[model samples]
Target: MTDTLNAKNHSIEKYLRQDRMPHIWCSGCGIGPAVSCFLRAIDRAEIDPNKIALVSGIGCTGRVAGYVKLDSFHTTHGRAIPFATGLKLAKPELKAVVFSGDGDLVAIGGNHLIHAARRNIDMTVICVNNFNYGMTGGQVGPTSPLEARTTTTPYGNFEPPFNLPYLASASGASYVARWTVLHLRELERAITEAMIKPGFSFIDVIAPCPPIYGRMNKMPLPMDSMHYYQEKTIIRHGADPKEADITLNGPILAGTFVDIERPTFQDQLNHISSKVNAQV
Candidate 1:
């Protein structure tokens, strides 16, 4: 490979689709920062952008597929995982990274998410958790905290939100981490780790949707939501996963919660194949 081919470019603009410059996401939306972090992570990993496959679903964050200049797929809503799963299984050489919103993944695609984790599929899932469904007029979602207000939850939400990292860890994901936009460096590092890890890796990014979810609440600007994350996020390193909880109104438990080595889905499949072939 030529030196230019592997050169580390800090500016993600070079890798972005210029025609999609003016993204559909609202101003002050956390999606932009999340995309930047993801790009930075790819750069940090020293992986060829050509070798990466970005898969996304229908949501504000899903616009990432249209923005990045890699092998990208803009699939149906809540089905990015199944698409990514097939891509990874077919071309196991490709690095599959899925980017989706909380509503697209944990809600409508909840079964896929858990099953993917349980299978320990070799891929990385980056979920931009803005709490409410930002693309759909700020409706209540599975990631919306208890008592949070949304378009559908005018009287405050009565349901509980899923602690995504915990759910992933419990579902057999080999690696799980949660980071907010405030921790940009940490978020990048977590993403890079997830990408290189040889098993099912899930990163739930606590993003802020200023125009929709934020506006409905007191945070009217994207920076306001970012500052809120700065103030409400308690940085606890090496924290116990069992003690972590997603906070809707208070300080949130944020950190790289889980990292364990398990037999990857591919590895287990190969083992089974060898055993079956021996019997034949």
Candidate 2:
């Protein structure tokens, strides 16, 4: 067991802050695997780690920035996108990535998220949607399914959850996709693709929050949620984002919903700047 543990540690040490071992995520939490897949995507993308910047907001997923060895920023709650946007605008050479949870990205910082997409900012946003607010006592969040029970909604969540892919596509994301943590290979591939893609790229990753969200929903074990994902998820590449809404115990539509080219915010800014300089 010691040898196995040492070998595992040795393999992933390069990507992590070794001093921060034994993360705070609960047992059966899916954030760890999502982070692992992200690191693998970084490796697969083959971009210089020095040229990458990771920004995250407050949440279980936000803790990702603290563990990664790269240039990472733990910003204010729900402000990861704006922070990443600033980083990208200041140094357009850097590949900025916003890693945060659904509650942080879609609830508190939702306005920034929509505008960032509307402007077609050059960044990769990886939103880990675990249904409820895992970090803040499992309150009902923007992505919590209708009728799902949360700490704040003991009776049941009645508000319609946002179809994240649809929102991204409608807001003008150039590349949008959705996948569960169970689909590691596909999720890694999607992340790799998003990292290399220009303009606003959004990937909604459905991860399990076994401790809080899961227990409240009768899925106490992580494997149960993973199994649920395996059984309920439908791979529908290029499907209309509007049809991707997730309902309580409903079939999950997962795939790349949009991939197209458009003038990025930086590109347009540079063009306008050049024109202004020429006129002057």
Candidate 3:
């Protein structure tokens, strides 16, 4: 058993800070699988791990940076995007990736998300949406389905959740996609594509918060949530983003809703600078 465990560890150790083993995530937490998919995607993309910088804010998913062996930053809450933006601008050669949870990215840092997308910044954002803030006592988040129960919304949530794909598309992201943790292959493929894409890319991962969100919503087990995802997910590769809004126990449209080319912030700036210099 020890040999088997060590062998399994050896396979993934190259991408992880093995000294930080025994991560704090709960059993059956989707974050583990999501992170695994990301590592695999990076390998598949064949980019030098040293050239990739991972940035994450405060949340369960934010802990990803701490565990990753690559250059990573665990930034202040709701500030991962801005930090990543600065990193990308300062070191354009490095591939900056923002990996964080829904509440940290969409609720407290929503303005940053929209503006970053609008500017077509060169970066990839992987948002794990578990319906609530899993780390901080499971409070209701911006992506929580309407009528879903959370710690703050004990009775049930009434506010509408953000249609992440629609938001990403409307904000001018060059690449946008969504998938659940259960869809490992698809999620990894999306990540791999995003890594190679030029402008802002966003992938919304619908993960499971079984310990809190699940228990409150009649899905106490992680497998139950996975089953729910399997049953509800509808793969539509080119569906309209506006119709991808997720409702409680409703069909979830997952796919690459948007993939278009646009000049990145750096690209536009360079062009303007060259023109000004030529005129001068």
Highest TM-score, which number? 3
RMSD of 3: 1.2
lDDT tens digits, residues 1-280, model 3? Answer: 3344563545567888878988999988999989999999888999999999999999999999999999999999999999999999899999999999999999999999999999999999999999899999999999999999998999999999999999999999999999999999999999999999999999999998899999999999989999999999999998999999999889999999999999999999999999999999
* TM-scores for every candidate against the unseen true structure: 0.94, 0.97, 0.97
| Model 3 global lDDT (CA atoms, 0 to 1) | 0.94
User: Mind giving the per-residue lDDT tens digits that candidate 2 earns over 192-277?
Assistant: 99999999999999989988998899998988899999999999999999999999888999999999998999989989999999
The better-scoring model by TM-score among 1 and 3 is 3
Note the residue pairs that clash in candidate 1. none
Rank order by lDDT, top first? 3, 2, 1
